[model samples]
Target: MNAPTTPSTALDKHTGEPLRPTDGQLALAEAVRNGETRETHGTQTVPASRYTDPAHFEAEKRALFDRLPQVLCPSALLPEPGMAVPHDQTGRPLLITRDKQGEAHVFLNVCQHRGTRLVEGEDVQCSSKLVCPYHAWTYQLDGRLLALPRADTFPGLDKAQYGLKELPSCEAGGLIWFSPQADADFSLAETLGEDFSAFAMEQSFLFRRRTHTVKGNWKLIMDAFLESYHVLRLHANTIGPFFKDGITAGDTVGPHMRSAVGRLEEVEGVDFTDMAALRRVITFAYQLLPATVIVPSPDYVNVMVLMPQAHDLTLVEDFMLIPEAPATDKARDHWERSWALLDGGVFGSEDFRAAELGQQGLESGAVDHITLGTLEGGIKRFDETVQEYLRAVN
Candidate 1:
């Protein structure tokens, strides 16, 4: 682990609050200290078809990913005005931009003139206006149609009606969320905003972001984060030694799951006010509903957005966020090393690899259902919540 960068008792530069644990988080620490963990009544099993069946995948798309609000990207991706990025992982062409007023907007990446894509690749662009390459149709960052090459030819063309088709979107807790539908219902997302804000995510800086294509179901990827049962085995060479076996406590905030992982060696007689000492003993993980995972490290955070494209294919946008941009070469090197270890080594090679392997095994029809033991009860709980949403739509 890298050395601590900030003093423990130092106030948070963003929230101006003590970096102490909350009452609920303290309860989790107490649970860890006392060796208390959550367990189900008995072994629970979810059918293998849940991860392999295409009909079920279609159902999930309609009931959950389609109807609900999902994370598009981090607001820091557009840290300043006149910044835009193209998002195509959701299987929809989307153009996310920050207007001159610094407000984030999500629009269909289609030009109103010829239905051609306004932006081609996934690169982030900085410009006051977006111009369609096919035709010289120009639009402002806010989706307003600014100019057209042959405006005189098309008599009485109302630019207002030809603006880009924008989806309902909002920025909260440092993330940008948008609904697949036209409605703007973000009640659940708003609730999660409070939880993420507690981590000071809104004030975090975007250090690095990468897109990963995982050969597994989106839920399979999500199931990996819901429990630490495989950490000792799957991540043994990477980050396993840092956490104690079966020393995690989890609770659900509405549809989201929150977990506290106890370190291998418990700290004795440590001061609660020392954030560094506290973090050394406890690692927190959050599984935000359908497929966003937020894990806060000692000096940085990882936010992953999982988008399911097929029954066995998932596109993961992994974001590494730091407390602030590295100002010195030494600081930059530290952050870079940290990012390489966690994002590239731990998650990419270990956790995601396990998910893909599980998918292969399940595809062979070797197992009818995957069994979850007491230590993996969080997976059962998350699957049950998913079923409720599916049931509602059915």
Candidate 2:
């Protein structure tokens, strides 16, 4: 894939500068803006209006989903030729399939007959054409209208005018991404940049999955994942003791951010050969622009992408990625066991409950604002990026 073009004299969306400030200056600016007057003890809060305001949510939908590189589906799940996935959150159905010429094309999955949906399930295969289950309207795998049920009944019905609506899509980093709206001038590789794209695409799959509906705002869920500060307190009985309390975060081009939590030297009761070696089990979290977090563990990796359903509800999909091939069953089994513990125990139980409770708090208005400490730097950067996007669209 061709690399994305980076302008030599482009200004940053937030700072409007060709170069960012030094580390110390940046930290100081962050502290001041966040109302942190004290060196390490001050804090500032984001108003509750930012969370509960309907207009703000609408702005987010346009700036983030309509104009960002979002992970729509995982490549492993839709690896077959005629597979299709429907994204109801975006108010459009996604038709993914390989054409007769052996290329992948993604289109708006809607039938011309009364605008009904064309595909329903996952991993479906059709050799000749994709026939609509509703009214038997047929279309070729390449999105050409093949046969309508009653073609002779209509006099001037143009088959050429009623093809499936196509969208710009690309497959990279073992994931499929599509823009829901037109006027997207950037490619997936361009949005992800060359070095990061190479690193992610080079890695293979370990395990993959889709998460159930999570009750919270999409930004709320994303904010929860952006930082590891809550891990020590909320996950105290779970995976908290294994990680350090502090967080290190950095912002990248686009809406992406990378974060790392310090690893604990030793857990009280756990026995391991080398404490230094055990520190290799650090958590690496990468937020892929708008709504996806790629979390890499020592044994495996998991991706959490948020799909907004309403003002206060979202669907979070989780996918696990591993090396292309594993040498031994023991290594694979180890990966699975580790994944189960993290997914079922930590995220599904602890973090999810916290988000729900936080949603309740936001709704209650007991506290008008939510504070972001220095430890939650990634969350602050995410909010700033969202603001930048809204500014662009406006």
Candidate 3:
């Protein structure tokens, strides 16, 4: 990988640290100032078959999903050693654990003998070994086969050869990432880029997690988040009042995106004393390449992990991250209120409803393609990124 690039030249006065790219400094500044965003070189109409065909869906799993690196969760999920997390995804049963050394590891969640899932539930904390329930075969947090019941019964058995298969894993910017296959010198820093390291991803704790199964393609689920063109009509009763119509600006870091939108608070002229003041007024979203999205909100960042179940179904895990766990009942109440307002009102009612409806339309064979305007450039870039990856693979 090439050397990392320097972060933005703008520095915060208080910390002497580089400020995260703000709407004031990033690509959308001029357009955002004029209430416009960058347009594509030309309008592109993507075929509807890309969303409906089974062959194309399978190709995507192999070309995009299987080969690319994917996010597991935030590092805060495992604050201490011995913390274990089990995830049910598209392929093999997978589990994650922080070892005694405080290092995170990802592994196939199956036991070698009978292939029972090593961990039963969503998460756990074990100071010792992870024991398989099927045969009581035990393995260490770092993937070493420790012991099993009646070890003497096996002839020429090698514990070293039977250890759990570890997957490629890395942690950076307070988040964990993994790839289905391992690369000896895989660098998350290279894949994510230097700009990601610049942001202060504080010691945020997961507050409320809500998982939902949506009747829409995974890409369709993601596309809803990429464009703000329908905010006014779709989110009329919810967050639309807070944001201007189709007024968003963003730039891509490789396939990853960081977009900023003008909040109602920023509409009137305001001066900032520090970077902290600036962050309060604007909304920034980081659409991590392929499938994850992290939108840093006023109180918490909403982390959305989209897992494709089938061509027409998607499993989304939505996590709300706060700087610290709520210490008071009032604080918890405030979080609950905010979550209900955003997730229930905006996402559930506004964004997701649109996707399901769109899926019904596409599957009806009524439309051959979906049109993209210059305003929805972010959505175009996402499709282009997938095409680029698939082309190289093919």
Candidate 4:
């Protein structure tokens, strides 16, 4: 491994700390430069039914999505106190709110009074109280029932008991995570929180976010980020030239996975002390178990949270987080161009389009299984992790 020719005193623009590669990152850089990749001993295949079977999809919802903790949104979505948003992508209407204390909560969107949805739409609503559209029931941002019209009409009505039903939730690593199951455990987030915090996610700025209803199984969308095998072919015009073909390294964090790709033509001779030089040579992608993909670029990070709506449908919430909000016209233009290239061109046009096309082909009953090459081993590993979750419930 090439050592830093000179230790740099420059601080990281985002975190204000002297930037250097970790031991693990150094190892990955060496592997990429040596033309080495993490591969399975033999070719692997996943059943087409895994992507198209209705029964299997429902099982996944019941065993995994319902029970496991999910990333509701980035903390930047609710950047300020007294902010609330409606989220219905999990096949259940949910309300996410941040109280005056800046604490986050996830509650069932249903009104406690008459079971009517208390909130509607995806836009953020900044208010101290949430008023039910029907009957005028009002609740605090923390899910406490505050007031209701015509209170005298109801006998022995306890306002305390009528608070909105809340689920297990916490804000960590600049993201809001919640479980749909009332009794779900959140122990898994401890490690993942540390990993995300390492990237200074909590301090980042939310530049832009948009939701898409894509025609593909949620896993199909996730599969695109786990491998670099298709980068040169599928994204040849957009991002291919910026990355080395078939040169990648990865490791698993329990069910989660981390992958790294090198951008430089030769990483062996590059200086590691200079953060700028090191960043130009390597990029990291993190797969938060289930369906969240976090890819940090040189200047910004992209987070995609996938919600499985059905066997062939997925709700994708895409977020682009930057170091800070743009303050000048030049800075805004730079961030805008980066967003357009990545969010609009690379992911929307190339990666997601490929997933939709793959779904269409699989739907036609052409192949029993989708074969994976050595370079695409991350997909096979992901499938295995998912199967472990399904098996636990059975």
- What does candidate 3 score on TM? 0.86
Looking at candidate 3, the ten consecutive residues that score lowest on lDDT are 1-10
Clashes of 4: 0
Alpha carbon lDDT of each predicted model? 0.84, 0.63, 0.72, 0.82
Better TM-score candidate (1, 3): 1
Deviation from native of the Cα of residue 163 in model 2, angstroms: 1.9
**Residue 300 C-alpha lDDT in model 1:** 73
| lDDT tens per residue, model 1, 1-394 | 5665755664667667776665666677677777777666788999999999999999988888888888888777888999999998888899999999999999999999889999988988999999999988999999999999978999988999999999999888788999888875888677777656656677789999988889999998998888888888888887877774647887777788888887435745656445656666778898886789988886778999999989999989999888788999999999998888888988898888888999999999999999998778888888898899999999
Q: On residues 1-394, what C-alpha lDDT tens digit does candidate 3 reach at each position? A: 0111222243533476755643333444334545656567677788898889878888888886787787777777787888788887746688888998989999889999987778877755666688888888989899999998898999789999999988987877667778876663346434453333334443567787777778988888788778777777787777776775435777776577777777533644533323344345556677776688887664466778888888888887887776577889987777887788777777776677777888899999998999988767778788888888888888
Native-referenced Cα lDDT, model 2 = 0.63
| lDDT by residue for model 4 (222-302), tens | 999988888888988988877745468887766778887884365768876555466556788988878899887765778
Any runs in candidate 3 off by more than 4 Å, and if so which? 1-36, 125-127, 184-202, 263-275
Query: Can you write out model 2's per-residue Cα lDDT over 134-238, one digit (the tens) per residue?
Result: 889899887889898778887899999888888877766556777766765556445453422322332345374757577777777778777767877888877
Residue pairs clashing in model 2 are 205-322, 206-322
Whichever of 1 and 4 has more TM-score, that candidate is: 1
lDDT of 1: 0.84
Highest-scoring model, TM-score? 1
Instruction: Count backbone clashes in candidate 1.
Output: 0
